[model samples]
Target: MKIAPDVVRAFTPTGKLRASINTGNPILAAADATHGARGVSVDLARGFAQRLGVELELLVFDTAIKSVEAVTQEQADIGFFAIDPKRGEGIHFTAAYVLIEGCYAVRNDSPIQANEQVDRPGTRVVVGKGSAYDLFLTRELKQATILRAPSSQAVVEMFLDQGAEVAAGVKQQLEADVLPLGNLRLLPGRFMVIQQAMGCPRSRGAEAAAALASYVEEMKRSGFVAEALQRHGITGAAVAPAA
Candidate 1:
């Protein structure tokens, strides 16, 4: 695919391509030994900058909400995000490059054994504020009340602290979060699967969005995305289907 000058410009208005990196989601990104961000999202951003022939700069944040907010506020040019309709108000997403499972965790003695059993009345679910799971569950869950934690890493602690019935988030995160307590168990199946995509501010115009969508599709077809996951030793997430 030939890269357009306008599309390159849209994604790199600051001369350098600024990518908002969310380290909160370890499946997508994490801190390297040097304390710099590295993972699937970071590798994808570097590839994007290489294609654009621009310098790449990472804007690090501890949570996806902060990362998405940075892109929407134009603090950064683009970001990796879950393709959610609520976030679409100020952002336009390209074809999803990855898919991650979202799960629900509850104390072993709790009544919630299946994914479908989590939304009953009087059940309180804890999630990271502004996370993809938070947004998804907020819309889909009518009876269960949601409690916001400071970040995804804090959801388990918050859930235990508040004695909430369930903790919901990325599957890997739920598992890691439950380890210390050693008493919580994930539901048998995932409640949702989040589509991870690259997004630019809507203000950048459709040309930018189209260009990115094309890039993501090309990356998928050429195995760039799958290879990146393997190289990073990332699991529990898979390349998203053709968009």
Candidate 2:
């Protein structure tokens, strides 16, 4: 069913459901501003609103935890982030449309040249708190000391400032901007596969969930998904079928 534009519930300036953006990438920021919102998350929310015939409201938060909280508390309808199964308990996730890889980023001068190099004792890795990379490090890299930051930028900053031996997060994001402090390098191997999806409150019923899922499938099949990625200059990655 095509979502009618008029049937979507209107959100007040301070509405119940707010859309959030990570704010670390320029593309995300531009997407938000394209629709007079604030980030890619907001743009995607607007797209959903248009598809479903609903009005959208935008919410800006500094961290992913806050974004997730907005949805859990019913302050927002959904959040956009890399998907992790462990996070499933806190909210419901639509099928994943983007695949990201978690890997280590180190300065060119750093001795670590590969993913295996990071597992050695005494290596300090910086990761954003509550991020997929953080969870991966906690569970997979037991031997390394992990430093938690509030955002991906903070993690990148730590690496740039030489605060840690490694910075771990989405490879695409890490490679987006130039690092003036030093050349950034991705470890030779991936730590985990990250599937980014839209997350809604788990309290919603199956019917609503299915409707959202079907909409995502339609976007994929109709080429809207590929177009969005390309519009953002996100090449070299395949848009997977909605998970």
Q: In angstroms, give how far residue 229 of model 1 lies from its true place.
A: 0.8
Q: Give candidate 1 regions above 4 Å deviation.
A: 33-35
lDDT (tens digit, per residue) of candidate 2 on 1-243: 754322233322243345655554333444344544353345567777666554566666656666667777777776776677677776777887666677788878888877888887888888888876786678888688988877766778766666688888777667753245457777776888777677776776455566667766777787877777776666545666755
TM-score of each: 0.96, 0.83
lDDT, model 1: 0.91
lDDT, candidate 2, equals 0.67
Q: Judging by lDDT against the true structure, name the best candidate.
A: 1
On the 0 to 100 scale, the lDDT of residue 185 in model 2 is: 73
Report lDDT (Cα) of residue 157, candidate 1.
91
Which pairs clash in the backbone of model 1?
none
- The clash count for each model shown is 0, 6
